[model samples]
Target: MVHEGVLVESRTMRASVAEHTEALDRAKTLSLLPDGMHVTTRMVADYFEVGIEAIRSLVKDHRAELSENGYRVLTGAEVESFKDLTSLDKYTGRHLALFTRRTVLNVAMLLRDSIVARHVRTNLLDTEQWARTASTTAPVDNSVIHNLVAWLDARIRETVAHQLGQHDARMTRIAEDSVRTVIGQTVVPLLNHAIRADDERRREISDIRREVAAIDRALRARMPVGGMAAMDAMSWREFEEHVAGLCRRDGCVSVANTSRTSDLSADLVGRTADGRTLVVQCKHFAPYRKVESGEMQKFIGMAKVEYTADIALFVTTATFTPAAVDLAVRHGVTAVHRGLLERWSAGRALQVLR
Candidate 1:
């Protein structure tokens, strides 16, 4: 007997089957066996030209329904018996899910991705219409009607299988053409966009590097070449006033020159626009000389503790020793070298040399 919708009550099955005779037709069209014969899961997969794994996945998802409708897990003697019946000596595994013709048809009706299943459905509809016409005009014998229906079903299945084979070949050619079309339409534009973005990034970096190099050269050119001769010409008090004036010109407010010996670490004190106290220590040394780390250590202590300044600037007419610059950096001090002093004195923006 057919096991399709076997889980449902006999009364419900009759009502449902009467309302949707197409489902029964689809089953007959896709079935590998004749009306009374049994089929397996692998047989159904092969008949539909789809993967066995696809059938297994469908059975796994609809286990309850499929199991009730002629799906069985063969074990022990049943497995060996099945192997013997099929003459498959290599089929040694047990606990395998076997599907009947009804279950296979059920899977075909439910499957969404298989093109062969779709063709099977269409062929079933066509066969059902032909069967209806033949039944009305044909002889009253039940056996003759059954034989006629079986023949028509076989013919429909064969035609559909041939069409699916041709479709598979056509799809293979279409897939090959699609690869070339995708490379031209999609991949090439993405590659071109990446190339353009990379070029723009390189151009922007080059422009920034050129601007920085230009600023560096201008600062170096402004540094004194004649040593302390240019700076020593002015008095010590004049040098203190020069630093205070430079600070005031460069956004420093409330500038004061405390040049007396009592002024411990700060020679000039001012407030910036952001209201941060600026503490500066000036050294008008010769261009050949460098400020030592010992002086920087003393200035760092006063800036952190005594002055409580937000920005500590160590300005000099000479450059700083590597040790002095390192210490200044460690303590977050801005070490203004001779070039920076020249740049500031010339009214250019102060670019602190940390």
Candidate 2:
């Protein structure tokens, strides 16, 4: 008979080569998806025709690059949530599918129009003065970027929590799907717009507020137990709470708000962990709004006398004027917009915090 030891060695070599080939295939596939595609283990199995056990080996061999490029190795609630939402329609079995579809389509159309407007304004950025002035080809400021990302995460969580609490599953899911579409289509160009808007960008802020209100209206009208106004109020509260949390985390200690009094000096205030008090002015503008230079100047003034904080921060869901940013720098204040916040909170950067 052939030598048993030789036979075992041959088998081991074959297994190793097969594993190498499988790993290379997975790496190639991962390179194709966006950096944001949070695919699950099951999806990987389905797509790659591999066993769950094999996935571990493949991931281990290729994870360094693949994981960094958005093929995250998920577990715990992350994996579970991704699996749960893969087929959201399954949750609609007990409800009227037709009603759900209509609501979703209407919300989507409204969001689409907003996206178009956003795109038009953003396209103006390349020629805009502010963006060129503020543009930094180097890596951005890590702390400022992180604060913005955390702020956006708080906003999304607040919005989702409010929607879930106020509306039935069908309507809530519809609103979510619609919002996703709008973000995908509008957000990129909107960033460009935010980057470019000079002194005139605050007009865009008004537009954003209308868009935000529209989204709120579409989602709130589907609330199961409350009037639309009640639902809207709940969402606004959640939004404020979320903003407050962002301020607290970003070295602002005692954050508060006064949309009621319209006192713009310091809507929020607190101290950094180092005992340096900080003041924050918040603007939860609509989807198309841009904060003006005047507001930035006002925050600087507030920081000097009223708030008496060590630093001033302006946090908004909209863009800011380049002059506003310059003014903040001159006055030792920080201005943060939504996109930076979203990326910091939900993007790869947050991993460092953990």
Error of 2 at 341 (Å): 1.8
lDDT of 1 at 208: 53
Q: Each model's RMSD to truth, in Å?
A: 38.2, 31.2
Give me the displacement of residue 161 in model 2, in angstroms. 76
TM-score for each candidate, following the candidate numbering: 0.35, 0.32
Per-residue CA lDDT of candidate 1, range 275-309, in tens?
88888999888655888999999999998898898
Candidates in order have lDDT scores of 0.63, 0.46
Residue 152 miss distance in model 2 (angstroms): 66
Give the TM-score comparing model 1 with the true structure, all chains together. Answer: 0.35
Which lDDT value does model 2 have at 216? 56
Worst 10 residues of 1 by lDDT: 27-36
Segments in model 1 whose C-alpha atoms lie over 4 Å from true places: 1-229, 351-354
lDDT of 2 at 302: 72
